[model samples]
Target: MTKKLTGVFLVLLGLFATGTAAVAAPPPSGSTDPVGNDVSWPQCGKTLPVSPAFAIVGVTGGLANNTNPCLAEQLAWAGKSSTGGTSQPRVAVYVNTANPGHSGSWWPSSNTYANVTVSNPYGTCGSGGGGAGPVDLPCSYIYGYAKAYDDATIRGVTNPGTYFWWLDVETGNSWQAGTQDATALNRATLEGMATYFKGITAGKKGPDGKPAGVGIYSTGSQWGTIAGTVPPGSPLAGLPSWLAGAKTLRGAKSNCSLPGLTSGSSVAVTQYVAAGLDYDYACR
Candidate 1:
């Protein structure tokens, strides 16, 4: 499905990581921030924006375990981006994320994937017959790792480790809701996915010399509701956030000043909707 964009603009002031004071909203006529578009399965047969400054292609069919039918074509579209003056890559990818527990069609029954043994924080993830619950932190983490592995290996992405990844954590997708345990499990799943990406990008680096691995995409409210508090030592902590919810370019720019999902992270990109399509603004 296409990405969902929702949220209001706040006029509050703030500072960037470099200590530069925040800029005013409704950027000047010749702003330097690159404007790009994001597309996914829902745009399969439709006309996409021509020569976007950058492009974010979705790898899933709106679910964690499903593949986007148009991934290849959309990726090609992304590769053709002009990149303009943006710091973001011409082509980046995002994937849907969820934690449906054992209720999911595919659940991990072991703390391993591709022969790598995971040091699961919640203990060994195994069948309930062996004392481990059918659904636990280890299982959730393995499930996330498995999903990302499949997405990178079987979802048509080439040299998957070379590109940056964005985890799409939206309330529209399946998630364990309602309590602290639910939030922890959900966070475990995301951490598992991030681990896979981070491992593959071990020797790789982005334009800024940071790992070209995993980032997150979601609204603040949705992120808080789904992942709750990210522990200081968690893998998901300190990763950049791609915020959503603005309806205009000005709103997106303003949102760049909003707090990120984690304390050490900041919003590196902000999304807006116009003409029924999703547009992203890259923050410097």
Candidate 2:
């Protein structure tokens, strides 16, 4: 095999080995402290050897650049499976409000509003590759609506109010820096998304009989770099947090004790990377 193909094979093999080893024994019992896993297009068509206590399937393939090819199948699996005697499953979407490439880019200010013409100097956005032009809604609204639309249209999620939604933010994706204004814009983008979801699920209640809440899936450092310190009394501060960047189950469990980026919000989940697989520890 070519070097590139060899590298890819090794990575996959490593992931498989790690996933298998990690679940060699059944997870701990209890509905309150459930164990779960999250996946994207990469794991499509493969059945997990061990059934997760819960699952968080991905909707966007990468930074909203495109929809996941296996989104339908993943959603179906989540919907069909029951965890802790609950039918509802968790779902997550990629968020990159300031990436400078692709139609999903949210930088340059013009792309912040719904229904407006924006100039893309970085050769991102649209088929022709960036320039002055009218685009769809802002990145936040577009991402929020795209996620809700995909869940409803493709996954048959008629009432999204029933499931928990997570926004995946990571340093692996693009971000803004060098200026305070850039940070503010990023915060606005995130808040816009939360606002949209809140509006849609206003009167709707989840299977738990509570309005579904939006949560941030990120590490404190990553969040600080992208959006800066979450302002006091900010709406984002009230949303739940899903901590990431742990390397082991022990580390992940420890992360659960860390304070959330939002002042009022607490860490609801902690993610650990094992054998290249993303596993979650839900905080009871």
What is candidate 2's lDDT per residue for 1-58, written digit by digit as tens? 0001112243344333211122333343322445677766556555442566667766
**Top model by TM-score, which number?**
1
lDDT of each: 0.77, 0.55
Error of 1 at 180 (Å): 3.6
Measured over all alpha carbons after superposition, the RMSD of each candidate to the real structure, in angstroms, is 9.4, 7.5
Q: List the residue pairs that clash in candidate 2.
A: none
Question: What TM-scores do the predictions have?
Answer: 0.85, 0.69
| Model 1 residue 260 lDDT score | 88
